[model samples]
Target: MTFKELIEQRAQEKNLLFVPMAHRFQEGKQVYRLGHVMLYLDRNVIFVFNGKTWVPTSLQSLLDMAG
Candidate 1:
């Protein structure tokens, strides 16, 4: 599976939300619910929302936390 698809699958397994960076904002508000994650394909990285900013994070780090 593709990286994006893998992320989506893992996120689902962990019950965490996954969203594309493009849809980050909607109606002037963040589209992702608080405590969710955003995928930035351009940078080929993932970021987690810390209630303020999108913080860069690694997939392994997230998986470690999930387990």
Candidate 2:
């Protein structure tokens, strides 16, 4: 199975929330690499991928930035 599909299934099974990086940033899928499955635990607690590692960010801050 593809990475995206795999992640979707796993998220459903684990009851975890997931949103693709493409969708989260309001970008097109073609902008991101294929099979890029970046799933976070919840909307309140988001995990951001820096060049080195995943870092946590609050939903409120994310909302602020989006506006």
Candidate 3:
């Protein structure tokens, strides 16, 4: 699925507002925000914003932690 689709599905499931960044995942910019969590994906690696910096994490880890 596309990034928008993924965001929509997760937002519906969690009953939260998720906003995708105005641009696609390129270089190292953030891609989306689920509630207050900002995330970036590049080269199959996911990085989550931890208030101070982007930390590498897995998709499963992110979902579990997010929930």
Candidate 4:
């Protein structure tokens, strides 16, 4: 499945929430190469590192973005 698909599936299965990250680089100034997709599943919400700091993005929002 595509990254979006995986995210959606996870959201459905676990009612996960996504938070986009704000920092694109690590402390070493090394750029992340995760291809605009990263997820941190917390008890209340999932954190998504979309090339930046963590920001909340809902499953519906993800679908909209994909489209």
Highest lDDT, which number? 3
Better of 2 and 4 by lDDT: 4
Q: After superposition, how far is residue 49 of candidate 1 from its true place, in Å?
A: 1.5
Summed backbone clashes in each candidate are: 0, 0, 0, 13
TM-score of 4: 0.36
Q: Could you give candidate 1's per-residue lDDT for residues 1-67 as a string of tens digits? A: 8866776687788777665445566334434331333334324565555557766678776555444
Q: Worst lDDT window (10 residues) for model 1? A: 30-39
Which candidate, 2 or 4, would have the higher TM-score against the true structure? 4
TM-score of each: 0.46, 0.33, 0.58, 0.36
As a whole number from 0 to 100, the lDDT of residue 16 in candidate 4 is 49
Q: Predicted candidate 4: what Cα RMSD to the true structure? A: 9.1
Give the residue spans of candidate 2 off by over 4 A. 21-67
Per-residue lDDT tens digits for candidate 2, residues 1-67, read 7544564465556555545445443122221221233424333345545457656665444333333
Q: Give the top-scoring candidate (TM-score).
A: 3
- Expressed as tens digits, the lDDT of each residue in 3-44 for candidate 4 is 544665655565444434567443323222122455444443
**Model 2 Cα shift for residue 15 (angstroms):** 0.4
TM-score of 1: 0.46
Descending-lDDT candidate ranking = 3, 1, 4, 2
Higher-lDDT candidate of 2 and 3: 3
Angstrom error of the Cα, residue 57, model 4: value is 1.5
